[model samples]
Target: MPDMPALHALTRSIDSLAPDIVTLSDRIWDFAELKFQEFRSADLLIGALRRNGFTVRQDIAGMKTAFIGEFGEGKPVIAFLGEYDALAGMSQEPDVDYPAEQTPGASGHGCGHNLLGCGSLLAAIALARHLAEHELPGTVRYYGCPGEEGGSGKTFMVRAGAFADVDAALTWHPAPFNGVRSTNNLAVLEYYYRFKGTAAHAANAAHLGRSALDAVELMNVGVNFLREHMPQDCRVHYAITDAGGRAANVVQARAEVLYLVRAPEMSQALALAERVNQVAQGAAMMTGTEVEIVFDTAATNLLPNLALETAIHANLVSLGPVPFDEADLDFARRIQATFTREAIRSSLRLYQIDGDVFSNEKIDGTIPLHLGLRDFEGRSHFRAGSTDVGDVSRVTPTAQCWAPTWAIGTNPHTWQVVAQGRSPGAHKAMIHAAKALATTGLDLITSPDLLSEVRAEWFEKIRQEPYVCPIPDHIQPDVGWG
Candidate 1:
């Protein structure tokens, strides 16, 4: 554990510097950048680190938007991961319900990644400041990880050994609850399936034409039927990206479908994906078409690290939750009105929160670290989404925490959440999260025994299965329309 004085001073420093951090977050939110295109966001973070006396390396992993900032020296090389990407069609004005945008139909930070980057950066800066002041013996690095939304930016970074030498890593996401993530997240694989057939005029040579669209439909039907037999937790989703020729007068010659397979573990996800591929093959055979599959992105399931969870939970408790003001409470109430009572009630119940609404006030106390796999209604658990973070957990000791920054039932990638991302309430949550992360980093640096125990537990939990990338090396990130 970190000394009490050091923890207190760290928290105070974070709180005192809250405005600067909030400004950074707000600027990123205003920029509303997207994956692989976070040029300004990356520059902002990298520039901040440089100004703070940290040496920075840009264009990491052949990605212009990816970079690393480092400070200090010695045993534990702790890296703080940060993201700054927005979602398309989520542009909105701060605190507005309707689609009010400075640039209409533009991308926005609906995922709250603007805050994610700023909070992580602030945490890193705070830790760097502490180490310099106290002469701490450890190295701290900040990774400006881009394209987390769908670009698999970290996959490239991890492949390049960006995180190989780190003793430990820490990350956090803005959410509706504050707790250390100790449960396993689902593994996911994404790919595109293309079918090729011969095109012919429908009326004159329909019999001779093999419709690629037919193959796509058959594949979807096969997978839908397969769902009933697969494990209940397994998930399969797909969308038609191309339907060949648009004119009904001709038989379609080509079609494409994007498929995403997810399961509780990576092995299962891969197995399910293979089964899906078989379905595609069967479809191709039945339709007299040839099929080709191209993998886009694959991510592993989160390997829970109880050791890191415990350390992070301790810091979460020590820093407590974000202190809310009366105005903040009023804002929360207004947002709560947009949701049905039943929905709000269910969300609160899932997280074990009693109130119908959450105020700006700090949480009552520290929440116990949760180890069991659990689901939250209207939040992360109720909705299953894949993230590249899952891959990092499989490779090294990693843990993530979440802090509530929006209305009770606000979902990511929605306009409502995007609106809140630019609000003062969200800013406060970001600051609180930064303090917790910084405090946890300090504990890791000051306590060598804890880090060793964490590493040991991580090893025991994983049992030495080497990490395999879900996205094959041949696949490149496609920035084209999904």
Candidate 2:
């Protein structure tokens, strides 16, 4: 727990700025910009940070929507990662009972990043003020990370030396349940395989036509077959992006398939990607088509910081449950009504959490820490999803927590989570997240020994196995729809 004076100050500061934080979150939610196109979202945040006396650097790492805000000066540069990008095709109106798109097939904050970016910014602003008023010497930074959903914005930033000087980093995610993010996620590799063939009339010259679509299907089949032989944690998925033209009378001359390969480590992920590429080549050769492989993005698996997670967990416990009212529970119950029993059970099984934890139909208190939060001996839960924050973790001692901002059993990138974005419950959790992050950051800033321990562990881990940004230098950010 943080010192009482600092804790009280943090709480008071967050409470004072609660209205602004909610406004920022709601505004971003409304904007629903996708990936690297978050111009308005970035502008809103940058303006707010400048207003709060932060020196804003726009377009860091050559990504337009990616930027960082800095204040104060010192050795211990503590950073709070903020992601504002929304998922494509998930646009939905908040406080709705059913699937109601604000704009059909548009972007939405289904991942709760509207709350994510704003909450971390709130912490950054509060911490900046606290440092100035108390004459503290640490620097506080807020990174306006774009394209977290799939763009690998922070991974590119890591390669650009963005986090080299940071002593530690902190961030949080909006989730259905509150807990420390201890599970290690898979390292992801994304690629687009473009196949070109000879187009011919399907009826008149079918023999002369080389079907690129056939190659795509073969590649997918090869990947699916290889999955059985790969490690249980490894995942390979492909999406047919371009299936030539929509004419049934013409043979497909061009087709595209996007592949996402993931594993527990970067090395493993790369090896798997190599095999997948080989399958693509084989498919191309067999179909007599030319194949062009384009690397889109990649993120390394998260490197966990035990000491930092301990601090975050303690701070989260100290802050206690977010004060939710009966109306919030009522709304949560309504959302819960939409989820089928199998869907709820599937969510429970996926997280390995007991169903009774959400018996109240809402998550107000912190969930119990998982026994397998850390994998000292390669024994931990496998997080199938990927995030650019994993790249930041590679560079410094980083830790993130999940704050409950939606009804239990709500899945990300879905209408359910989007529908709760503007709820009072969501606002309460967002404020609490800011409080937890700010308090934990304050503890790290003040404690030299603790920070040193975290850094030492981070250094030792990196020394044992150095970090190499998975995305190559030549691969630029492709913010288009995957």
Candidate 3:
């Protein structure tokens, strides 16, 4: 770990970059582009990185929005991950408490990726500047990861060997609380299964038609039955993306269903996915339909690095909680008023802590120092949502932290979350988070003992069961419609 004086200097260094950090975050939030289409957001970050004397590389691993910015040289190359993709149909006007959409159901930064991307980039830039000023022998990289919403952008990057040389990784997410993200998240597999059959006129040749929709329905039923036999920790969900046609008279010729299978581990999730495929094939056989399953992507369960998490938490405590004024509290109270009692209950249920985020509106002004350490498998606050960062963790010694950027009880991908996008509190929390992440990066770069212990744990874990890309070699990134 870095000494107190050095840590203070690093914190001050990141704080000085607050203006540029907030500006870049607001710019990306304004763009509000969807997955794989963050052209303007990517350009903004890339430009800022170049201005800070970092070498920029565009369109990594065939993702147009994905890029990498590198600074410095030599061993212990540390990478800071940044994601800038927005969710669809979540747009809301800034600084509003009501459910008002900015463009009436357009893309928005409901998940705070605008803040996420910029904060991580700021961490990288601050670290780069630190290295240059002190003439340190280290490397820093800012990974411009796109398509995190239903698109595994980082998983694709991992498969492309993007983090092959990275000695360690640090990242953070904008959330409703300031704490260490020590939870073990679910591993997931995403695939689209299509069923094709002969189409026929319902009135004249109905008997000649084989209903592909029937196959889809049957497959769903089979999957529901399998749910009972599978691990209780597993989750299976599907959407009938195409149900033949809108016309009731026609016997549907073609139908499609997208499936997402999640479990506690990658091996278990893969097994569950195989059973799902079998169910699909059975459905096809029974209905005389030809089924084709196209692989989309998958994310491994997040593996935590205790060494890194503790170091990051120390930095968070050193910075203390983010300060909020009367105006900030007033706005947050209004936003909290919009949420129902059930929403507040759900938000705090996972943490099992006091209810400060609801009434206080600025989150619990404390760091979760021993977060998930004593819990079962470090999953007492297990994340139900999947992230491409899980894939990154498999390859590198990675850990993440969380910073409160919105009012409590505001669910992600909702207009309520987007409403807080431009709040002064939100910007302050983001800059504070950047300092925490950058400070952690500095500790790893300077301390060989800490980095070695972290990597040793990571390697031993992987050695027992090595990482296998969930997406097959033939499968490519399935970019969603913008």
Q: What's the CA RMSD for each of the models? A: 4.5, 3.3, 3.4
Q: Candidate 3, which ten residues in sequence have the lowest lDDT sum?
A: 368-377
- The candidate that wins on TM-score is 2
- Per-model TM-score, in order, reads 0.90, 0.94, 0.93
Clashing pairs in 3: none
Question: Judged by lDDT relative to the true structure, which candidate is superior, 1 or 3?
Answer: 3
Among these predictions, the greatest lDDT belongs to: 2
Please identify model 3 stretches exceeding 4 Å from their true place.
353-381
RMSD of 2: 3.3
> Candidate 2's residue-wise lDDT over 39-77, tens digit each?
999999999999999998888888999899999998689
RMSD of 3: 3.4
Ranking by TM-score: 2, 3, 1
The local lDDT score (0 to 100) that residue 126 gets in candidate 1 is 90
Q: Residue 46 lDDT in model 3?
A: 94
Give the per-residue lDDT digits (tens) of candidate 1, residues 177-265.
Answer: 66654555678888889999999899989999999999999999999999998888889999898999679989899999999899987
Compared with the true structure, model 1 gives a TM-score of 0.90
Q: Name the better of 2 and 3 by lDDT.
A: 2
TM-score of 2: 0.94
